[model samples]
Target: MKAGGGDGGSSVSDEEWERFLRASLEGVPDAPEEPSARDRAAAARRPPERAADTAWRAYTPPRRRSRKGWYVAGFVASVALLAVAFAPGGVTGLFGDDARGADAAPLAPESVAPTAPPDAGPEAVRPTLAEPFKGSPAARWADGPAGITVPEARATGWMDRAEVARALRLSRDFLVASNLEPGVLRGERPAGAIALINPRQRDVQDYLAAAFRSPGEANDPVLLFSRFDPAQARLVGDVVKTRGRLTYAEGEKGAVRVTADVTFVYPIAPAGGGDAVVRTIVRREVVMSWDDPAKVITEPGTFSLVSYRADMTNAGCGPATGRLIPSFGGGGGGTASGPAVDPYDRSTSMDERMGAAGDEECGTATRS
Candidate 1:
């Protein structure tokens, strides 16, 4: 990226100009005498020399005073042309250069309405909602009072740092202020607030980086291509209820992880329902790796490469074998393999216990 004003035009200085002039003229020869004043062939002079003189004599000479006046007139005309060409507006009587348009107005400090950039990538042009969904795909369990029927995900992993702590702090402040986290996830509702977030692993900073983010768009440091709304939330709910799986499992090692599969569903609603129902079967898993990964690897992200399959704490791994029997191939595609149900305290809330794992990096929060 070009950091400062372009072309170094602002860096020019008077001393530098003087140095440039000196270097340029260092070897230039002295001005030669004007040929017209050298010899006159008329009268006392040899009559204007040869046959070539025909063309020379055709060029008439003016009186000395007139010559001086002619020189002054030419100089004035040159200066006028230079002034017009280099004017503030850079005009040619009736036309302006492209630069003039750029310089015509003072830029606003707030923000300029961005013109479409020539090099924006795919999501740059995507239409996004003003609001976004909160709560993880697996959080859909809160949807069913019958109990979270979502498939039990075998997850394992450990945190290198305590990012979940920071996110919780911010979430606490936000919940206190708004009374409702924009993605209002009322777990078994009409009671207290747990502030579950929407799908974040899907809505990435740059999909390649796997940057972790909060569920709410309002708390985001910078805006994404777009936000989510109630309609989108209802859509998310449908997708989760139908075709989703949330794998949240903890190993004997203190490591913890969770994962889920999700789809984008839109325009879905319940029968005569005011608040839309979340309905979709998204397959998700969480993986937590230990300080020493040699122990376990079966949590959602434990695979590290293709999948995560372990969360190893200083304690040890559960499942005895530490084997993440592949449920599906190619990462949640092809077949739906049943997970080995060693729940190992499966009937509990993943967040309330070890808290959501950090799927992101450290210290680069954007300032809105």
Candidate 2:
């Protein structure tokens, strides 16, 4: 091959690069000083450099280098093409493939949003609001009616006409049971039963009869018995003053199924007559059940017994009449009920609260 020959990265000239390569390798072999002459002389040099150099210059280098550059460029172009073709959808999604699309496509517009909780607001999700009870197992309580092991759930006490008669059999009986003296009862008594004051008292009896319909108005004033007779419970008094009505609220509180606070009044009747003579004061409450029975105590604050009840309530219900009463009880506040007198104002005697019956109230009216 001649001097000035081609190499892979360079084009071939009149003289192959072989001569130049040989000259270069042979320690800068001189060519003629004159341009043209020098070129010719350089071309006259012996065989081109090493065989490796000759072959490299003759064919391999130029093509190989150009192709390598082009291969790199092609690869870059392929990437760019991919980006351009799929980029409109989104850069991150340039691959144009979606694994979750099938499941997503069929849902309605509203369904796109996640499920919401009943209590949770739109701003955030709520796992649950019913947090479990904390503290010792003995102290914790639930949110509904507790266990039911007794029939006290039914009512207070039930009595026959005889029991009602005992409530007010004789004037002296009324005095003894009610802690009143003959002087106090027989007009000779200021604090005696009204029966002593009104015997055929039409207005008194009529008015007292009207009150029997709304027992709630009495609010467990008091119930004191005179003596048993085969007749209805006598009116030791009539409801006159009531309080705590505004506190008549009902709802499940903690363990209690139902709780309510109500106040009422009852008027005392003359010991001899069947008419109301004085008014009494009373405060009471109603409780249905508890959340934790184990922790339950038959105390005034823990639960309630249906010791006494009323005929009407502001809740728009007719007078509640039923055969129910408490079994065991003596005295209590806020929820107290029995045939006893109020230690406070003494306006309402114990007989009124207990649904006391007597001979005075007997023939006056029959049991409804």
lDDT of 1 at 322: 12
Worst 10 residues of 2 by lDDT: 64-73
lDDT values, one for every candidate = 0.19, 0.19
Q: Give the distance in Å from residue 226's predicted Cα in candidate 2 to where it truly belongs.
A: 15
Writing each residue's lDDT as its tens digit, candidate 2 over 1-368 gives: 11211121213331342233223222112321211111100112111112221211221110000000000000000000001011111112211222111111121111111232111112211111111111111012111111000111221123233432222122222222122221211111122232321122222223223222222322111221111111222123111122221111122222323322233322222233332222222233232232222232221112222122222111111121110111111111122111112112112312232232311110100000
Candidate achieving the largest TM-score: 1
The sequence of per-residue lDDT tens digits that candidate 1 reaches over residues 1-368 is 01111111213243443343234223223322211211111112111111211221222211000000000000000000001011111112211111111112222221111232111112211111211122211222221211212332232344423433332223222222111121222111101111122101111112211111222212221111111222222221221111223334443344333333222112122223333322112112222112123332121111211122121111111111111111111121122122111111222222311223331111100000
TM-score of each: 0.19, 0.17
Model 1, residue 4: C-alpha shift (Å): 24
- Predict model 2's lDDT versus the native: 0.19
Candidate 1 similarity to native, TM-score: 0.19
Clashes of each: 69, 66
